[model samples]
Target: MIDIRLGGARPESAQGCVAVPVPAADGGAPVAITPGLLPDDVAAEAAAYLAETEHKGAAGSVQSLPRPLRQPSKLLLVGVGAGDEAGWRTAGAALARAAVREAELTVLAPAELTDAALRGLAEGLWLASYRFAMIEPKADAAPKLAQVTVAVAATPEREAALAAARTVSDLTRFARDLTNTPSQLKTPAWFVEQVLARTGARVTATVRDQDQLAAEGFGGILAVGGGSAQPPRLLQLSWAPEGATRHVVLVGKGITFDTGGIDIKPTEAMQLMRKDMGAAATVCATILAAAELDLPVRVTVLAPLAENMVSGSSWRSGDVVTHYGGLTSEVHSTDAEGRVVLADAMAYAVARLEPDLLLDLATLTGASRVALGKKTAAVFSDNEELVAGIGTAAAQAGELVWRLPLADEYVKDVAAEIADLNNAAGNPGAITAALYLREFAGPLRDRWLHVDMSAPSWSGGTDGELVKGATGWGVRTLVRWLQGLAA
Candidate 1:
């Protein structure tokens, strides 16, 4: 991890490059930076290098003073791109990648940086520096980047921005750690133990054991985890302070490791199945951030935790699983177990809490991944207000999301032969899956949105704040949305 701190003055000597923020090019060569940002000889060479190179100061563009190296002794100017929050974050990720082999960097503050922009930069640095090293490498192996110091005037705003970024980004890393853990260690019961230990007193985490689940009739959760030695669990983490009104409930599908149950996936497909619980990881981080930030809005997270493994006891494709509140779903494909368990949590949230707003998140469909690719989240709902609000918040949080239709036309495709709903809907799979979850929404259907984040939930590479696995994709957006509700 990189230690990000505020500094008053520039250091005379540094192990790595000193990066200064430069805005995007308006016209001719990118906006020029002062020679004060670099050594005279190196600055002169960089000037000549810039004239020969195509460094336009666009976001993620970096111009090393003398020459670019895997680990730079100096990189003079990094593009801040209009100096917005996203720009700062992009710059931080770019710089971190460029200087990974070096010791530290001292960055000069932009001329006028907002609190939001500062937070973005700090978060980018912290998140990009994250490495999930469960195993210790050789002593001579590449060392982690140590520190980042931003040369800026200290103020309450600066302190608040840095503190907020640390809280959110650290929790995001926490979620990443959870997602990156091997499936052998992250069983449903073990996941519940993590929730209890991690959340502690900051957020009230309650767990309903297997017996409680059976008593409460969470047939979907039980059936999904039946093959595993570790049983299913219903975990609720709440952040309710005094006098808070608007109640928001989020249900996350927490399938620890999905081997696709009786309808098992292809051999190569199960390799990344350990990340199937990404929705639960993200939701846990989001609510924890809310509690830490002391957001004055009542919010609760309902995670139906299970592991869909293959065994004699595994749920079959033709089986009917009754969810919480007695909503029966016919399992057309055991691979579609995510929505089956997610329905139970959403129904429980509605029947018990009666929240003012609801949203369910899961790595549900491959069709969504095909439609939106791996970097963007796909959302579906009939609730116009809910969609709009989430759009605004996602944009502000620098998380990309595309709204897919939640048209009722797909409802017919998901109607079951004998049960209340069918778990699998053929093509245009993303929309049909959303319609299926909406079956249990009841009154909340019109006020809810279902996020099929199959693609963004786990990343193939470490780009930006996201690491290579378990992106913790929705934490920032949900926290930002909750911040808006409090405001």
Candidate 2:
């Protein structure tokens, strides 16, 4: 993790590269800088550079100049086009990427940056600076922006906001590590131990093995895990703080590796299947974040772990699996195993926990990816208010989520001829998948929100706060939403 702190020495006295925020001038006026932030000589030097380069102070733009002072080697003018939170965030990310070779950075914030904008700046820097190189690389190959210090007048509110931003970034990165782990080391049993290690003492951890799940009738998990040498597991982690009035139960699909069972996916498609467990990583990190932040809300997480592989024992497409609580689902496509396992977890959550909100996230459908593209996720539910609230939370958390209609008319499409429901219903797949999960929600349907994060969970390339692998998409949004309940 990068070392970050708030309210260090003044910009002129900073130890490493000094970065100064420069707002774009109105109507092409002269360059403007905070009156007291920089010394007269260095400010004059920066003004000269901006004029020479014709810099307009566009958001996420940087211009470097030699510092007149002998101590600091360089001067950076980071742009905040509109000086808004979004602009600050972009500026922060851009600065981080630009300062990769520097050992330390001292960022001079805007004179009037609000708590919200400050949080955005800190979050952008931390998230963008994250690197997940698995191999042992040469010493010179590593980028070295190890320490960051923000130079500003510190207040309790500002310091608290910084700490909060750090917490979210650190936890989100933790989730990213889990999601990016190779399936060889990330089996169902390994995942459970990882959860137990991080789940603080305030939280309780329960592990149900294949035998327990079989006795308890968790057919969906067993059916999915039947093909792999690794058995299935159901992990329930809970953080129930005192005086908590709201309870939120989150369910996630934990397919550690998906060869798509007997019905295999294409070579290219199966390559990234290790990320099939993204939702489980996200929800686990989220509930643990709630414990770390010590929010006044009760949170429970249910993760159904499995690996859908190919073997003679693999569950076939025509098979009907009897799930927990005696509900039956026809496996129309073994590739649709995410929602199958998710159904068992959601049924367990709905039956055992009385939740103010019931939410489940999964990388369940490629159709969802087709509809929403790679950066945005598709959310489904009958609760309009809950969907709106989730959108708001995603916006605040710097994650992307869009609500897709439940389409009650499509409810009939999820029905199977022989069983109660079909795992893979026909076209408009994302909608029918949500509808299928709703069948298992059973009377808690009204409060349930299902997120199909098929595309957003894995990033194809780095963009701003996103890295190239497992994106840890939902942890930020879910954490912020749960924390808001405390208010």
Candidate 3:
């Protein structure tokens, strides 16, 4: 993790050269650090790098100035593409990673930093700062980032900009911690307990255990998780809006760990199974954000959590399972457990909570990764307005979200031979999973959006702003979307 601080030297106090290093796009040049250049060096070198190299502020390019001359020793000037906020943020992340080798570093922002740019920079740093060292005994050898100096040219606005960046950093860290937890320690029960312990008067968390679920007819959760030793749970968290009529429902698939049940997953595929609860973590984090921001809109989050394990009691193929909303589903494949849990949670949220808009997220399908890849999150929904809102939110949050079609024609694959629907669809796995969830959502169909976050839920590579574990993909998107609605 990087420690951030304000620069001690104001523009008037500058006495030494600051290295304005340019990160070569193709690794063509060893990082060039111009010593003793100061702020003027940063400006001059940035222009020269941009004009000479025409760096598009592309993912690999340098984005910001690392103040090497300052007491911190190294100032990195990273080139964010074309002066855009996202570009600068991407650059900020690149610089953070490059500076990991340094004992500590400070980043100097341009004199006039917009709120958007500041926010992006903070988020990028947080994203890039995450390190998953739990499995590696030597992981602790990696030096911690001691400080980041968001040095804006000394002015009244400096304080505000720095303050804003700090706020964003705090929120980004909050989201990151939720996403980084391992499944073994972050089960549904544990998550609920944590929420109960964390939430104050403004938020409420309710967890329904196996016995309560059985009595309440939430069969979808029971049938899907029945095979595992860990019992199923439904965590409902809510906050009342102040003088607001609009309400939003957020649902997450909280499979604490997915072992593919009777249809076991391969060893490689099961390695990151702990991140299967990413959806749940995201929803929980978003709810906390909403409460923290005091959004004037009623919000309800439903996280249906369970461990998908193989056992004698596991639901088998061809078995008809009844859900909470009185819908019968045929269990064709036990591995398609995410949608099963989400189906019950979505229904409960829409019917019981009665939110005006619904959005649900899950690492539910491999097909989503195939469609959207690792950087972009796949979004499916019938409502264009909601989709637009989501798109805007993702843009603001500096996250990637691509809208995918939820074609009505594809809904047939979920139709079962003997039941109302099939838990596992025959084609378009990701889309079909969302389609399966739609059945239990009832009449609020147009207000719904489903995010298939299969790719971004966990990382195989430690790229810029992405750690090698759970990414906490949906937290920022959900928080931004809800905040936008509130505004």
Report the number of the highest-TM-score candidate: 2
lDDT of candidate 1 over 287-351, digit per residue (tens):
88998899998999999999998888889988999899988988899998999889889989989
**Weakest 10 consecutive residues of candidate 1 by summed lDDT:** 7-16
Considering summed lDDT, which 10 consecutive residues are worst modelled in model 3?
A: 15-24
lDDT of 2 by residue, 1-487 (tens): 6677777887567655888887777887866777777777877777888888887888778998765557466878888777877777777888888898888989877557788888888888888887776797678978789888878778899988888888888888988888899999999999999889887689899999999999999999999999989999999999999999989999988999999888899999899999999999999999888988899999999999999999888999999999988899988999999989999998888887878889999998888888989889999888888898889889888788988888989988899999999999978999999899999889989999999998999888868778689888998899888877788
Identify the superior model by TM-score, candidate 2 or candidate 3. 2
Q: Which runs of model 2 end up more than 4 angstroms from their true locations?
A: 24-31, 68-71
Off by over 4 Å in 3: 12-60, 63-73, 101-104, 135-140, 153-180
In model 3, what lDDT does residue 100 have? Answer: 66
The count of residue-pair clashes in candidate 2 stands at 0
Ranking by lDDT: 2, 1, 3
- Ranking under TM-score, best-scoring first? 2, 1, 3
Query: Model 2, 111: alpha-carbon shift in Å?
Result: 3.8
Model 2: which ten-residue window has the lowest total lDDT?
66-75
- Candidate 3 on 1-487: residue-level lDDT in tens? 4665555555334433222323343454433333333546445555665566555434436543344535323334566544466766676677667766655454545555566676666667767876655566365666456666665544555555545445445555554565567767867677677667766788987889999999988888998789877788998899886797888888888888889988789999998788787888787777777787777888888989888888899888888888887889988898888888888888788778878988888888888788888888899888889889999988877678898878889888889999999998867888888888888778988888899888887777776667677677777777778778877
Residue 228 miss distance in model 1 (angstroms): 1.5
